[model samples]
Target chain A: MTPHLTARNAFIAALVLALFLVPVYAVWIGNNFVLSLFTRIVILAIAATSLNLIMGYGGMVSFGHAAYLGTGGYAVGILAFEGVTSGFVQWPLALVVSGAIAFVIGILSLRTRGVYFIMITLAFAQMIYYVAVSLNRYGADDGLTIYRRSQFGGLINLSNKTVFYYLCLVILMGSIYLVWRIVNSRFGMVIQGSRSNDRRMRAIGFPTFRYRLACFVIAGMICGLAGVLLANHTDFISPAMMHWTRSGDLIVMVVLGGMGSLFGPTIGAVALLVLEEALPYVISVAGRVVTGHDVATAKEYWQLILGPMLLLVVLFARGGIDGLLASLRRG
Target chain B: MLLFIEQCLNGLQLGLLLFLLAAGLTLIFGIMDFVNLAHGSLYMIGAYFAATFAAMTDSFVLGALLALIATFLVGVVVEMVALRRLYGRDHLDHVLATFGLILFSNEMVRLVWGPEGRNLALPSWLNTAIEIFPGVYYPTYRFAIIVVALAVAGFLYVIVMRTRIGMLIRAGASNREMIGALGINIKLLYTLVFGIGAALAGLAGLMQTPILTASIGMGENILILAFVVIIIGGIGSIRGAFIASIFVGLIDTVGRAFMPDLLKLFLSQAAASTAGPALSSMLIYLLMAVILVLRPEGLFPAAGNR
Candidate 1:
């Protein structure tokens, strides 16, 4: 067996094993918090993976990926507020709104290349953010609370945290599989070719812009789905979900885990969110050990460490966690 | 009539601040081809420095001066440590690395100065209103901002258009390879240019703190506006940035002030209230989108880029 193949296969096997067992382990340990956290991780992982479709594989560095999240969440929130709580109606409507918004944004933003594309996407996202902020009926900047979770017609109960956790996990795995297939398909080849060299792709008779726009829309739809999941998970939706900084966070997750890899973004989501959940504890412990003083505020300063770590990752670990994993297989 | 004039003045002030920011950004992007997202952090640092120094010295002017110098040094140090490596890399690397810098700077600022926003107290002389036109009074501090920004703009024009360094900068922007071949100390030039951009950002922040208060994430908002201004003006073009900033400032300020009321006249009050801010905010971006569609290169494509 090629060590590389064996190692990668083993890694995937381990990852799948862990993902499947998390909820069971949570139930056995009677730790609902673990289940909820993993649920949230799975949702964000879906969002990051959507971003990776365009960013890592397609080479479109959209600085405003969170706009879809906001749109999707608002879609569900606004519909629920208007007394339509059916998952069937709410989810489809949310996806449609996200798709339409993505279409409009893609049509306009695709005109430019390089830095202009990034800035334009950012502007559109901000435009949407302000729109959300101005939405007084839907709770404006304060966000809307989903009083009643989506009614799944007795098929599933999102209120039960464990069930919801499994749902998220299954969907996350599904997204990974879908993205994996897309990256290996003919359409994926076109997208990858454009990323490597748009001009060359064009010379080879590929209408690169159309392909890119399509990719953009698809990613937006997936992220929109993620947004719907996020709203249900948190039972809340706010304008802050679509903030440009939040978009940056999505980008960070995609890059941190491993760009261009099928499982990179999911791994990234876990790493980032888990780190966020754990850093405060790590900080306080380290603070006490090093400073030997009251270290309550050290938790607040955990980001001080995180910021440098991101810089170090960008500088030296461009392959991210996934890259390190792949290298281990090769070695 | 009075409100319109006042709003116009407000627009001018905002435009000038954006201009100061955009000018520096364009120069850096043009010459270095580096996209520094941490530019906003410099502005934040500037405001923080001004607040601290002003409080310590008990004199606004001295503190502002000290803040400017400190911010410039910080910019230089940052460029040296973090930004230097990012040169010649893809714009993505620049965006990502600078983003990391933004996180570090924001968190570091929080660590040093609690979470609260700080305000710089305007001197009494600068605080009072003055009648520029018959019976149309305005805050002296704001008028001062207008005058100071104009003077700086004028000074910048002279330095960029008439000086030896200006020629080099122009040359570097248009063609860096030739300059490097000529044995000019390119690294020093980049550091200096970055420092200037930092100082300009700091100045805008310090000048703005009295009015807006020095707060976390303040730079991010205005930074977007500055990006809008530059994009509308044309990337890598100071002249474009100048016109676009003023245009955006006026459209933003006036639209925000009057759009809701205007909508209220045509539509139900309930709808107007919700749509007003959203519509007004979208106006500038709409303009940007239209500009991108029509001119793609922006209204004033910098000669250097061509």
Candidate 2:
């Protein structure tokens, strides 16, 4: 087992190395677009990783995870709009509100199991989405623009691309390290044990609800931090950030990168986002070669490929990209 | 008083519409134990079919009938091809696969019909409002929707309670192995059950097309509401679905209509106005959360064997 896990560990280390080196490569090549794109990818990777902590290891599938993204974004966007420009205040506020909402949501939703849990999480998220839409003061359905991004007191500049990229990378690495430590800790074992068999855990005299709920909040808090970065990355916030589809996308990333693995979320985020960007061009080119016409329609149908691909993944590749890679390494 | 009456009536109408959508959902979920996120896509397809066929035939009734048949066929085809293989699998698998179906169906509709929404015109005869009382006026089309939905509800009740096929469905719901033991062609029954569910969702979709234009995302918004109803009603209980659907419908419509006014009684006008719409949208969800906390199996969780 030790020998086998070495391959997986090496892969994760290499992936982290690439993440740090990306901005360097981008700066050297003067490719600002790739830098910005990877920055978004990195932020979402943090969110996906947070989701993986609960969904993959802890076995709680909260479909409303994007609510944290919205809450965190709005915390900054609304504050920035109301003249709170300090990152010190805005960032912590983002974390607190997301944590609070997740606490409330986790408490309420954790009562149910299975499909009910999925639907309840989804409903709660929709509630938040509607609330965002009703915030006429903050732009309502049109969404809000953060005229000024959160400012740090001469310590680090978020407005600088390379500096921001490194900041995100460091935070992401820190988060992963945190998750790794927690998973090996006693609390994580309880969460995992509960996920596998809550009844058995209870029979063994463990009070699993508080542990799971705490896990839920931690995941939400981490995702909330990601949301802050996301709002900073985009310089905008909308109800669209919390839409159930975005939550579904995060889930897809987790599942595709391989659930129940340390590096799955990061891999999933990169692969899914890269595919989204590339599939259109690839499909159009293929269409041009095959159909020799309807190029525009073909490009639009990239989602057509995506839908079936997801089905195949669920049916045949449940372990996702990370799992596949691990298996290949073993062979 | 008149406004209150009107809003209540509107709530009832909306509730009945939601019931039409929820009833089919409960049946499919309760009987087959499959989760189809693409259920809404079928609703969208039903509306699109109505729009296209109505345009072709220029008669609302004929187009509707054709849409129902088309939707039934589509549901049967989907069940046979994709969903049949997924029975007894993990609900997560069902969700992911059906989510994929949603993407497929939505894009297919966009590819086939273009992204712009299509509108269905009500017949000129049913276009006007009728005064049900001395002062209360309601649209004939809306009144028609209520009557049609009620009829469907009655039809479902009678079929489920009184017919042999209904007996088979109930038995299957409670004991899947028992149904197979009884020499039932489980495949055919499942397909037929799915057919009825598809037809019901399609009917709801097509019926509401004249009220709201048949748009791409119509089914999704209401689908969540249907889930709320189902969650409140209980996952596999049609009876629970009926009660929960109307309750959600009333709470949603009535809450939205009156919440601002209610908020104004104590709060500043500006504050009330600011919080009203957002608070109103949250009413059903609040109700759902309360129900989940209080009764996790839902109010009328089917007394199935599981």
Candidate 3:
């Protein structure tokens, strides 16, 4: 392998190792907060990874990817609220519902190209969000609280924090592997081909639309799974979970981590969530040095920096963090 | 009968406001071929500026004029400093970058003006209810908004259809390369178009501020509505945006007003009450989806425009 490949592999190995040891590290440090934070990071990482499948690889920029997250979460949340706490039923139903919604959305939105596509997807997601908001029986805008986690017939005890963390990690890794395989397969090639040049792919006798639709459904299903975990992790499901901004967050993760790379989304998820957690503190420290006061409210303005940073990244660092890392060896 | 008239008037008022926002958005999209998700931020900024200016000057009219000019300048600066570089980039890049702008705008607003919303109070003359019919009355401010927006729409039509700059804009929309090749200052034209768009959005925002307080993220929901307007009306088509904005505004406003009571006639009260708001809210999107399925090019496809 080339030095670039070796460096990337080493980084991935180190990342995986760090993730696996998070629980152990948390325990040693006597900080349960770290464990829970990592759990959220892993779950969102799964979401960003699925978004990357279509966005990075398939060349579909889905602005409303978080709609599936809400669908999946609401599936679990509504079922559990109605006393259907079985994981088997809830998980499958979440996947099916999200997939079905994705299929319908893809059919309509995929008809339009460019800005129209982005707007349509956003509108569809908003429609779902409003629907969720109007469901008064299921807690409406306030959201529903899940009292019990999904029961897997004693196969896995999710109540254990360590078990849950590992479960999320494994699912994330499995998804990354599945995406890698999909991109390498014939079907994957067609999707990528369509992304690069749809008219050419169609001229070559490949039905680009159906392939893209299928890919969209797959991404939706994976994001839906992430939603299921998110609901369980937080024990709440609300329309807020599927807001357009949340969808924006997932896109940011995919873009920031380095699109199309298997581990980019995961790295992005970790980096973003960690930054969100740590940025306020960083700002406050810098503020203290400059103003000589705590600058208590400085933490709230982290997005001020983040927003421009994103612009800079888009304008200059289009390859994101993964690309940044890859460039390190050359430099 | 009075309620229906009032609702219709409300619909008309909303449609006019939406038209102002949609017109600018379509022009920018048509001429520049740039996808700006932060158009909504300009709207929000406009409202905030109006509120601050109005509060400071204690003269609503003067404040509004100053706010409009400020918003136009803000738009120009935004185009020059950031968005100008984004031209010819992928639509995805535009989306991501503008999405960042939205976040930055929101946070900056919060930092400058505390997290709470600002209310733009109308003057006594504008705030009073005007008797428009033998037994009906409507708020003068709403009436003023309708009149002002309609006048602005007319002004836009005159400029686009009758002016030399309008001809250039139309030409640019149809064939950007040819115009650039023909020695037109395409950069200046783009900056001018972007500024005008920002002004329109700000006008819409400022006008609505009296009715709905200037709040953070307020532009987002309405921005989506404008998107639907453009989609149904056809992107890059001013006439399409005008017709679509009014159509969407009427459907949304009237549907929300009547849907719950109408549903109650067929279904139980509780079910109607719950489904009414949801169904009404979803009406425009469902309409957009159907239009997408039926006529993906939208109702009015601009000539020689993608």
Q: Tens-digit lDDT track for model 2 on A69-175?
A: 99999999999999999999999999999999999999999988888888899999999999999999999999999988899999889999889998998888888
Q: Of the candidates numbered 2 and 3, which has the greater TM-score value?
A: 3
Model 1 chain B: weakest 10-residue lDDT segment is B90-99
lDDT of 2 by residue, B10-129 (tens): 888888878877888888888788887888888999999999999999999999999999999999999998899888987878888888888888888998989999999988998999
Clashing pairs in 2: none
Clash pairs, candidate 1, are: none
DockQ ranking from best candidate downward: 3, 2, 1
lDDT comparing candidate 3 with the true structure: 0.94
Please give the range of 10 consecutive residues that has the lowest summed lDDT in model 1 chain A: A1-10
Best by DockQ: 3
Residues forming the 10-long window of minimal summed lDDT in candidate 2 chain A = A1-10
Against the true chain A, what TM-score does chain A of candidate 2 give? 0.96
- List candidate 3 stretches off by more than 4 Å: A1-5, A329-331
> In terms of lDDT, which candidate is strongest?
3
Q: Model 3 residue B150 lDDT? A: 90
What is the Cα-based TM-score of model 2? Answer: 0.97
